[model samples]
Target: MSQRRPVPRLAALDGLRLVAALMVVCYHYLALSRSWGHNPVTVFPTLHRFAEFGWLGVEVFFLVSGFVICMSVWGRGLGDFAVSRISRLFPAYWVAVPLTALVVKKWPEVTSIRGWDDVIVNLTMLQAGNNTRNVDDVYWTLFVELKFYVLMAIVVLCGVTYRNLLIFCGVWTVAAALAPSLGFPALAAFAMPQYAPFFIAGIAFYLMRRFGSNALLWGIVLFQLLLAQRYIDYRMASNLGHVAAEHLPSWPVRLIIIAGFAMVGAIALGVFDRVQWRWLCTAGAITYPLYLIHMFIGMTLIHHFRDRLPAPVLVVSVVALMMATAWLIHRYVERPAGQWIRASMKRGIEDVRLNTPARRKARWRPSLPAAPEERPLHSAGVH
Candidate 1:
């Protein structure tokens, strides 16, 4: 039999989510030159140096997500899994997308509006898959996330046992490795060679958490870390210009990635299991909304106030404002909206179930052959 371990509440991960969101926030506000309408490197020389590495936080988020998702979906069916994901992701996203579009229309500095077509498409959260522009650039990650969810859905369908999960990790790792050499776009999209390692490592770590680490799990994590490094140049080139990317050493990025792995490893090993505090959950509650709304909206605010406020003051105020807004959205909007979505989706899924042929047959009756016309029996020989 496959092993199972009781999942524990890891509030520290919630805190970690907030930290990752802040890292990306800092990177966007402090290190990204284009968004500021001037080189941030010149504006905040010292902070920029540190903030430049903050994009690694996204990697950390992916790792945490793999662990969290695997944990959440352990005993869930596909419908339940879909409902959970939809409920969790869409509530804040539905608000953030249009709010961002309106803000962009109002400011028009952070990015140009491609039109309502893009806005409509962005609402689906499949904009990245459709080759459409995302209203907020941070949304590109959502598409990657969606693909991972699809992959996991398959695992969920098969059942998320320890043995099956090990098979999944191995198959996915092999696929991700082969994706680059095969020149298959579909395979590459699904495997996500650049990002797969983080998610895979996260799953492996979770496996270690559940079943206890073995040579295989340890090997998978270590192998993925090495495989992950191959994409460093690709990430740097895409994020920074090739010339500017060349100026930055890859080691810092590599080290940060390693640290992210180490942190999750620590979590899997129960290092942070007892470090729980209630506020970390609240911090986590705001993370999704903050990440979704921060980019263009914060940039627009920064662009407008660059001359009016001190850089430090402006950045602090904006981050605080964003966090405050995220909290409001989480408290006032996400919880209720998520509940509504979950209820609505569950009802809809139930409706589908009731309408399926098998379910209909189970509910069906054929009148019991009219009780065999009830008249003829006992008189044939000896009444």
Candidate 2:
């Protein structure tokens, strides 16, 4: 049996995450013209062409999440896993939710808040499940991420292993592929048919990375790569709203998806394991906060300034502003708050464990008690 290997920190994935976030940023800021009331295609004739495809970044993010989440929970208990996720997710998110609400309240340009009720639900990050609105459209991805996390948590409970992961990836992939035909809403919801391949591929890549690539792992990656293309239209229709397939060539989108898998596959194969740069850490840290806060806040800024500044200049300024804000939130808010949340949750878990009924009985029961065992009505010899 192959044991789990101590995998080196792949700093390059951190860099890749920032790259993915920036892609989504560009997609939101430049590809769509409705937000700023300017034709982005004309304003960003060259860039808009590329930005149109930037939404693929979300797919990249899922792939990365698959790899990272599986890697993160490998040896950790469910309690530690929960703590890490809560601390890592909520610190920046708590700030971003209301901050985004405030922006929508003030601007109401690209999107708007329904009320404080919506804001409250968004904070829990279960807005999608509740059928409540997301403060920013980009937040839709967070719900997808949350679902993936829940599924991975189950894997952690089952114990992460090379064999177990193989079984998980196989079962999940089949369920996702069959979800629509099964005509089950809950199944589709949990299966996440459109996004499952990316996560599955990611897990497979991690298996390759940890256990070394073989025919089976490579086959899983290839199968997912093929299966992933099946959802391109659905993703485009849903995520891009009115943006039709005819507007963007299908070939490039297919190529980009392939490229995404290839990039992560290269990482799994240790092609770029030596490419660790200290700066990649900073880039990774800001990615989530940046993804959270960039959309509505950015569009609001562009709404006011699009007429006042040159198009390229305004776009650059908005991206810069978002990056700066993301950095500040990461440095000032996430680090300290994450530590605090981790400590608090740990204490809370300890309290729960100590106060359980079993523990309570053990703590209070007398040591002297030894009840006599009852004899059967018919003794063995008599019977």
Candidate 3:
């Protein structure tokens, strides 16, 4: 058997994760303040303008997820990929769900509760599909991420090859682009066609890096760029409207999108491969836990201190506290719990194999029948 090539830990990508997580944190800190009937932006107009663009962090995240997920499972089997994803996502998520619910329950000012059934659905991470409200609004993205995983797993199971990926990306992009117009609104919504371009961009980067850049890879990248721009235009027009879209300073938003795309391109082209910073790995490790836990906890803190402290100070303090909480969860809860679950799963699989009839048959062997036949033949000759 040929040895599988090991996937490199892209330190630059790890750093990007930290930046993305913080952007989301900042965005939520500002947006959630408004929900609590306090407009931090009114006090600090400049900061609010900057934070408004922070929602773009999610787009960056989708791009990173696309690239990193493909890289992580490069030579891995479907089963291995599934295990890795489950271990990474569920450990932090399971802990966060209850913690978020508890915070919301205790401090209803940050958000409201629809009851324990909603909490139960949140645990499944399919609350949207089940018509249950999320404890925190940030959870909608998790549903998108889960859907992406399912699609990627399908691609992996089919086989990960240049030609295969090309077809998959092309077909998916077409489906996403046309789903809304073709009476399949659910398809477009569930598959998140608007975000598909970013994900495809990530996949294109992976193909270029691993398989070596070619015309096909470049074509995919170009196509992704066009699709991404289209998606952005649509989003801005729909969400902000033509008047606000034109009036609002969109330079920051444009810069973020361009920078995010450029960063992925640079990494794919090997520009950042040699930049090894171990701290980035730590930053990446805590991002998931941070994202999961930050919204409710940070908002609650802000609600408590909004009147007592300056808006900027309150925001900064909440961010710092959230970061610390993320670190603690990553080190204590996520790491240990993931390790235990994976180990237990491995042992359970082994036990099942040992107990299987097929495996038992393979282990068993018949005694040499020839020995008895030879003895009988010798006795007959003597007689």
lDDT for each candidate structure: 0.87, 0.85, 0.77
lDDT of 3: 0.77
Local lDDT at 157 for model 3 = 91
TM-score of each: 0.91, 0.90, 0.85
Which candidate number would show the highest lDDT if scored against the true structure? 1
In model 2, the runs with Cα more than 4 Å from the true position are: 1-7, 241-243, 356-383
Which digits, one per residue and each the tens of the lDDT, describe model 1 over residues 1-383?
A: 86644445677778889999999999899988766788998889999989988888899999988888877777678999999899999989999999999999998987878989999999999988778999999999999999999999999998777777778988999999999899998999999989999999998887777667789989989999999999999888887669979999999999999989998898888898777687888998899999999999999999988999898999999999999999999999999999999999999999998998773444465534323322122211100
Error of 3 at 378 (Å): 61
lDDT of 1: 0.87
Backbone collision count in every prediction? 0, 0, 0
The candidate that achieves the highest TM-score relative to the unseen native structure: 1
- Among all windows of 10 consecutive residues in model 1, the one with the lowest summed lDDT is 374-383
Clashing pairs in 2: none
Arrange candidates by lDDT, highest first: which order?
1, 2, 3
lDDT for each residue of candidate 3 in 1-383, tens digit (9 for 90 to 100): 87755544578888888899888887777743543466666766776677666778889999988887776656556766777777778888998999988887887876778889889878888888777898887888888888898898988898665566778888888888888788876788756778998888898887777656788877877887777776666666554457656778656666788899899888888788777787888888888889999887788877876789887778787888888889999999889988888787777766866887773444467654333212211000000
In angstroms, how far off is 124's CA in candidate 1?
A: 0.3
Model 3: residues >4 Å from true position, as ranges? 1-8, 31-36, 237-246, 249-251, 348-383
